[model samples]
Target chain A: MAEQVLLLDFWPDPSGVRIRVALREKGVEYEYREEDFQNKSPLLLKMNPVHEQTPVLIHKGKPVSESLIIVQYIDEVWPHKSPLLPTDPYEQANARFWADYIDKKVHYFGRSVWETTGEAQESAKKELIHCFRTLKGELGDKTYFGGDRFGLVDVWLIPFYGWFYTLETFAANFSIAEECPKLVTWAQRCMERESVSKSLPDQHKLYDYILEHETGQNQPHL
Target chain B: MAEQVLLLDFWPDPSGVRIRVALREKGVEYEYREEDFQNKSPLLLKMNPVHEQTPVLIHKGKPVSESLIIVQYIDEVWPHKSPLLPTDPYEQANARFWADYIDKKVHYFGRSVWETTGEAQESAKKELIHCFRTLKGELGDKTYFGGDRFGLVDVWLIPFYGWFYTLETFAANFSIAEECPKLVTWAQRCMERESVSKSLPDQHKLYDYILEHETGQNQPHL
Candidate 1:
């Protein structure tokens, strides 16, 4: 039986880009369907009825929602090539812990950086910088988050680098490069891979997209 | 070397209870340390510097934080006994999706039900009911969330049942049993298991503990 894989995603979405990178890393051939939040396609709605959000991976007609879960799924299904998670149970757990930290702290604070202004934005900026520095400490002298291998934690985090332009442009005096240089270098290293370079939209393009959409608090909803 | 296992937790914590249940299900004997949030132990801080929250499982001196991640680690390490997750990649993904949903929706809104009053509490009550109903639909006629085996989804959810008394008592016109009968029945079925029955604190005791802590909008922080 032939393998059928489909991924529903929205352009310039960090979560969606994570799945794209994972798929490209695994060399998995999949049909990409872009979803419109306003008029969501029936396929996406049917596939992910609960969340009805982007980055749902449909493998053999079964849907898997959530970006991290999809990435893990992709890794498990295509285990022969470029293993994402470590084989040791303890190491896998540790990788998952960092990935969870990225999801809970890094992503959450990053949203606040571009979404708000004044004291709220300042606090978020501080928090985001702290998060990056913490990640830098975790990375230490390692080439990748998984240490020499571009693995689970790397896949979970590298996509956020695509939003660096928007975050720096919107949030006052914010420079991730200044705050965490090692993380910047790590991201650059990740970008050298074709899978990452192709999967992430140009950071400038993402900035323009967010600006065009007027996503900040003061701006009117389009 | 003898396997060294230790768990640090707070009594009546839903998250902590989850790890305890998983440990029991795996039949892994380990030392349990109760933590006092007022003056947190140095070990808790050292073990889980990132979150600094309860339910840090230390196995062979390596700490695994986050209840869900710890549960997965236990499952992987003790695969010889009761399986916590399915072997199939798709099934595992599906289980993870629901577990994530419980963490995001069910637990988040359940907090609101006890922590707010008036309009906000009423809104939370309605949302909690809707969440339970959605879960009911997902559960359907399954004997457990994993179907015939109490697996990931069940482990993620049953801990919340310990908070049912507090949620119902605090939120006006809210009754999970009335709103989602099958789900209530499912909780009862889960309670039959020694691992679940022992791990979860008595619902009434949990309610009293929350009351003593005075954790609500109007209550003074003690």
Candidate 2:
């Protein structure tokens, strides 16, 4: 039997980075197939017929779509090394709560910032800062969102920091690190892990990519 | 040791209904404290300081917020009598995917229908119909969303049928069962199950409540 894991991914996409980080954390060897959003791959379409979205993970012969769900599946199937979730149900639920919170709050804040102009952008920035501050407050001396150990929530949130920082720099209005000092520190701490460090693209590179693609578009100023 | 399960709930909320159904299905006797959203309970606030939302489950004193997470925890703790999720990893992932999708799509569509006006309402109705139709398509031949068993997804979605019927009657523009026959049948099938049926409020009563509330408010119709 062949050991296979295929990730349909695109660089700088936080959702794709989630699966990539999970794979690296688990030390799982897998094939990487970067997808073109304009021209999606046949396998990507076939595997994820419902969404036709990227970050589809094909493990062995089975395909799992949705970044968060894929991450959970990976953790379950490969539980020996670097468990994404905690052992206790309460702890696991806590981890999932933050993960879901991040999905609900911060995830869309970034998009709203990117897609809007003027007051909307300002509003999005405010929302982002508020979320970061809340996250920092939630951290409150914990080493990781998972508490004392880097886990799913840590990995899920860390990827977005790169883009967020870039957005702050280019926009030249908001300062995330200055506002939410602890969360910035947390992001840095998360990046210190080899899996996260290796999986993330350079902040400058991501910044340049976003600038190049986003110019002339009525995009939200993040 | 006392086996105490504390549930902070609102009688009319669908999210609260998800946990209630799970509790009933698992045959777990829980102490329910109703929350007036206008004036939330202290326990709800303390338990879920971040979201400060209702349907926070305090199991043996440990708080588990987020209805889906609470349901999953309930299933794990009491796995014998009723299995809310499948034991298989892939199947469980699929169940979670649908549950998450319903949370985003179905719930949001319902909210959009309730909270908007004119063109916005029409757009929201279109979105709602699209989601319901998609769900109906997905349910094609499955006896329930989980297939052969009334599982987590069903529990999460069944409450919305009450709201759906209420919306249909108020708007007088759509029939969910007529538009999405499969989904309508699915709702009926779900209600027939004692666990789910017992947990839901009567359609006419909920509709009357909604009518009374709408009449009391000078809100613009959307």
Please name the candidate that would achieve the greatest DockQ relative to the true structure.
1
Could you estimate the TM-score for every candidate?
A: 0.94, 0.89
Q: Write candidate 2's Cα lDDT for B119-169 as tens digits.
A: 887888888898887777767798987888888788877899889777786
Per-candidate iRMSD: 0.4, 0.8
**Candidate 2: clashing pairs of residues:** A114-A220, A115-A220, A116-A220, B116-B222, B117-B222
**Residue A52 CA error for candidate 1 (Å)?**
1.1
- Comparing to the true complex, what docking class would candidate 1 get? high
True contacts kept of 1: 0.94
Each candidate's B-chain TM-score, in sequence, is 0.94, 0.90
TM-score per candidate for chain A alone: 0.93, 0.91
Question: Per-residue alpha-carbon lDDT of model 2 for A4-63, expressed as tens digits?
Answer: 888888887888888989998888999999987767878888988878877888887788
User: Which segments of candidate 2 are over 4 A away from where they belong?
Assistant: A111-126, A171-174, A214-222, B114-127, B212-222
